[model samples]
Target: MMKLSLGPILWFWDKCTVFDFYARAAEWPIDTVYLGETVCSRRRELKPDDWFALARDLKSCGKKVVLSSLTLIESEADLRGLRRICEQDDFLVEVNDQSALQLVTAREIPFVTGPAMNTYNAATLKVLAGKGLQGWCLPVELSRHTLARLIQELEAEGLDLPAEVFSWGFLPLAWSSRCFTARHYNLPKDNCEFRCLQHPDGLSLRSRESQELFRLNGTSTLSGSRYDLLRQLPAMADMGVSTVRLSPELQGMEAVVQRFDTARRGKVPAFDPLALTEAPPCNGYWYGEPGMDRVARTNAD
Candidate 1:
């Protein structure tokens, strides 16, 4: 059976909610859990020690734990935090930035690259695979065809890193040094009161036609439509995808996990996973189309 893993939380939530989510996550039918702050370092709801404690707790519950680093490292302080995560010996570290990758490689530590790290071509994957790369999550923007080719190339080289796909949740499209949320509130990034706590699922962005376009959260911009791959489980399995990642959201995550778990076990979920998302569902990038376009699953695409 394909493994089910939870991606690190992309949105800022209160400490209580963070702890509570993990409490419930321990009992979910999840094989792996990623813990850490992958976005703005300022959203420090959980300290490094706190994340390690959580990782250990989850590990104790028989769940594989991975510590994720920030997507965009902007300062020495952020680098320090990334070093701390990479230097640790407990859990596998998910490298989101090149800095994190360099740190791990320098230490000869085994690591996995997150979606944000953009491990697209076979050449990059091959190099990383030789340099202590345990696994990699396909970039969210890559299509299924591209992934299939990458996997074939890896097999040709006898490389054996597990391939993980971002199978659910809103796609994090871009990251910036400036916090868009703070800018929306007309506050500077420094003095910007932590307004991310107010928008749990992220403050939505819409076009002039009132079409949901993107979500502005801290320094990251995400797809307004939730990127769901519930119906693509069988296809992924056929393509030899070893793991499927479900990004954490502020609400309805347990239901999301349940549906994915059921599908991974060869059972069709009774309800549509799209119905659980706050925004319209999309799987465009996965289908080799525009990021917002939805393509119904068929044999080829």
Candidate 2:
């Protein structure tokens, strides 16, 4: 069975809400829980100590916890933070950028490559593996055909590092120095007053025609249509993907995890993805098509 891994929470939320969210997640059937802030460093609802505490709790629940580094590390402060996460040595660390990879490589510690890292080919995978990469996350834009080819090649070479795919949630497209959330509120990025928490799951971008377009996260822009792959569980399993990552949402996360869990276990009669989220679900990337296209529409109104 393909294991379920809860990706780190990318959106900002109140401290109490964040804690309560994970408190409920601890009871889910997920095998892995990624902790820490993967977006803006300014979002400090959970500090390093807080992440460690949460990770410990999740680990106690028999879930493997991974500390995720920021995708865009721009400052000495960010470097220091990455170094601290690398030094912890208590849990797995997911490096999202080259700087974090450099630190992990230098320390000779095994780490997982986060989806933000542009790992496109087998050569890149080999180089990272040589640097002690224990797992690899396929970039969101890469199709399942590409992933299957890479996995097949790796298997032929007998390099069987665990593979994880971004199975659900909004597709994170880009990260910038400016926070779109603050910009939308007519505020500066540095002194924006942590405004991203106001819009859980980030703010939705709409076309002038009132059509859903993209999501403006703090510094990251995501696909307007959430990238859902619940209907493609069998394909992911056939591709030898060891884990399916479900990114956190603003609400209804526990039920989402439960549904995927049941589907993966064959307990459900037919996987009803309509019960997942409010956004339109998509899995076109898996079939080598546009990511926002739906392979299986479940009438999720």
Candidate 3:
């Protein structure tokens, strides 16, 4: 059966809200839950100890927990945090950057590569697998054709690491040193007053004509439309996708998980794309088309 895992919360939420969200998640149908801050290091509503405690609690509830490292390591403090995450023996670590990968490999720890790590070709996957890569999240921009070829290449090389796909949620595009959210508020990145908390979902950046183009989440820029692959579950299964990840959102996450859970069970649940998200759905990247195009799923695709 294909597993469903919840990605780490990308947007900043209050400490209580984060706790409550995970507390509810413990009872959901999700088989795995990723914990910790994967974006900006300054969004510290929950400290290291707090995240560890949460991970422990989730594990006790029978959900596999993985601690994710920061994507952009700019300072010594960020490297220190990455080291601490890699040092954990109780949970798997999701390496989001090369620095984190080095730290984990130095310790000879098996780690999963996050989507931001850019495992585009089989060669890269083989190299990481040689470094104790247990699994890898496919980069968001790669198409189904590319993934199929990579899978074939991996099989030919006798490599058998599980492939996890970011099947849902806003696609995180890029990260920067300058916080677009802070700039929107006319504040410096150093003391931005945690303004991201105000918009549970990152502030949306729309075109002058009012078309949603992108989302500004701290230092990360995300696709404006939520990437929906609910209809492609069967295709994913046939492609040997071991797990499908659903990025956390501020609202209706339980329903989203339930819908995916149903689809994974070989049942095609009714899914209205627009109702599930603030913006329309997009699966063009899966079909090797424009990232924003909505392509219907078919066996041919």
Candidate 2 residue pairs in clash (backbone atoms < 3 Å): none
How do the residues 1-301 of candidate 2 rate in per-residue lDDT, one tens digit apiece?
9899999888898889988988999888999999988889998777889999999998998999999999999899988888889999899899998888989899999999999999999888988888898998999999877998999988887887889999889999899998899999999998898888878887888889976778888898999898877777777777799999999996788878888897687564355645544567777877778877887543321
* Model 1 per-residue lDDT tens digits across residues 20-108: 99999999999999999998999877899999999989999999999999999999999999999988898999999989989999999
Candidate 1 C-alpha error for residue 83, in Å: 1.3
RMSD of each: 1.1, 2.8, 1.1
Candidate 3 accuracy as TM-score: 0.97
Please identify which of the two predictions, 1 or 2, would achieve the higher TM-score against the true structure.
Answer: 1
For residues 1-301, write the lDDT of model 3, one tens digit per residue: 9999999999999999999999999999999999989889999889999999999999999999999999999999998888889998999999999999889899999999999998999999999999999999999999988888888899899999888899899999999999999999999999999999998988888999988889899999999988999888888889888999999997899989999998999997665543754787889899999898898767673
Model 3 stretches astray by more than 4 angstroms: 270-277
Q: Cα lDDT of all candidates, in order?
A: 0.91, 0.86, 0.91
